[model samples]
Target: MTEEKRIPMATIGFTTEDAREAARDSFYLDELDRQAEIASNSIFHAIMRGRETKNPHDPRVWGALQNTLFATICIARLLKPGPVREYPGLTKQQSQKYADERGEKLRKMLDVEDDCHILDVKAVRDAYEHYDEFFDRHLRDVS
Candidate 1:
């Protein structure tokens, strides 16, 4: 008779150490690093193109700039994982709060400072999500 292997399910709300440990060892970390680098470069190139265009009203320039910022935020989110979202044990609100706290630390670690142009990356993301009309303003006038 052939032996069958059984994968153990979570007994309670806690994630299995094996799963977390596997994630730590996974190539996903390396991939995330690579993706971050690519997104950074993309932002730089987009800004360069915008400058070269020398036209404030150029849609291509504005589109690239906006897309890059959104891409950067997405990459940042991928780099920050939440235990509740990945595993279990917390309410949705609690999970979101925990993720937000971690995201704040990540922003600081990345030296993401708010200024006249960009008050907050997360806020920008939220605005983009909650208000489509926000984009109607001239991109050049964004600042």
Candidate 2:
């Protein structure tokens, strides 16, 4: 055998805080990617299942679609501009204000001229997430 090939290695240095911050950012980015994958997979499943059943109303199709919507909402939340490393303690109103500001900035940064309607599906996502509450409210109204 010829002489063994040598591999090069480099040392990167960072403060402890920088390392922690990088880890947090990595986690957030990974989560965003995971949610995106989930949304993509769920939509694909929904389409395939819907075609196979020839029924848009099929429960399995609906389930997959719901998953897609939920995952999309999670992605939207993850994209909300904010500190990735730490949760800043803020009152509900203040937090909402901050989010709104950040959201506008994010939209501008992404060059999004029009609102993404899919992000508005948070209400639908909530309905699916809290189905029991939805059912109870409807049952009460019916009674």
Candidate 3:
């Protein structure tokens, strides 16, 4: 006669101790990091392109996309099982305060978590790679 072996549900253990937890946490952490980097670099590049274009209106064109990225990253940060849950959405300020605040929050995440960064390096490179050639070489002119 053969008896069936019952496996416990919700078991966090794998072949290695804490390996599952580490892998899960690492996945979320990577995602949070990726989202943050994309948000950070998107606007940073937009701002830089604005400067290169020498136009005050350049960034305005990217406002919506920037806002979306920030919101998405903020959500990812909140979901990462840490102190980032209360992240406030970008404020609707008339001045540059909104931009400044976004930049500050995005960069500051690196200090909170060791494996995190101001922006995802790959996302930044991918975002800007051939940016000029593919983006009409104008980056939606500010002026």
Candidate 4:
């Protein structure tokens, strides 16, 4: 019979918890990468759809632009230093503040000289997301 050799846990220099933490970190990074790739693909599809129509006012073109905008926002948020979190109780202003902080962190990390324009998409996103309220406000103003 052949003898089997095994390394002791002490020689490994890391606890099982450390391994678990590392695995969790890796999984998080992989998930972020996957989401970014999906967003990129959405942007690519949007570009292709936009190219298919010459009229900017076309519904297809508008839809594509909307997708591109949302995708860009996703990518921008992904660029932030840590995992994204959802604060269900946060108000709109608080949420915007959090986003601004994340964007600033990313910009600083990247050594960007100019403002991160991608962060500015929140207003456009909000308008689209709350289109009913936006349209109602506009109608009220017009009346």
Error of 1 at 99 (Å): 6.2
lDDT of 1 by residue, 32-104 (tens): 4666676677778777887788778887766766676676565556445334363278778787777777556
18-105: candidate 3 lDDT, tens digit per residue: 7975655555456566665666667677666666765566655366356545645454334332222223653344224544443445
Top candidate when judged by lDDT against the true structure: 2
Off by over 4 Å in 4: 1-15, 57-121, 141-143
Residues 103-133, candidate 2, lDDT per residue (tens digit)?
5654565554445775566678678879998
lDDT of 4 by residue, 1-143 (tens): 99999963323234698786555445444555665576667677767877887876877756656766766566556454234445688876676677667556545655653456754666777778899986787798684
Give the residue spans of candidate 3 off by over 4 A: 1-17, 54-56, 59-72, 79-143
Best by TM-score: 2
Local lDDT at 124 for model 1? 67
Q: State the lDDT at 7 in candidate 2.
A: 89
Candidates 1 and 4 compared by lDDT, better number: 4
TM-scores of the candidates in the order shown: 0.47, 0.56, 0.36, 0.49
State the C-alpha lDDT per candidate.
Answer: 0.60, 0.70, 0.52, 0.62
The RMSD (Cα, Å) of candidate 2 is 7.9
Q: List the candidates ranked by lDDT, beginning with the highest.
A: 2, 4, 1, 3
Error of 2 at 94 (Å): 7.7
Query: Positional deviation of 69 in candidate 4, in angstroms?
Result: 4.9
Q: Candidate 2 lDDT (Cα, whole model)? A: 0.70
Judging by lDDT, tell me the better candidate of 3 and 4: 4
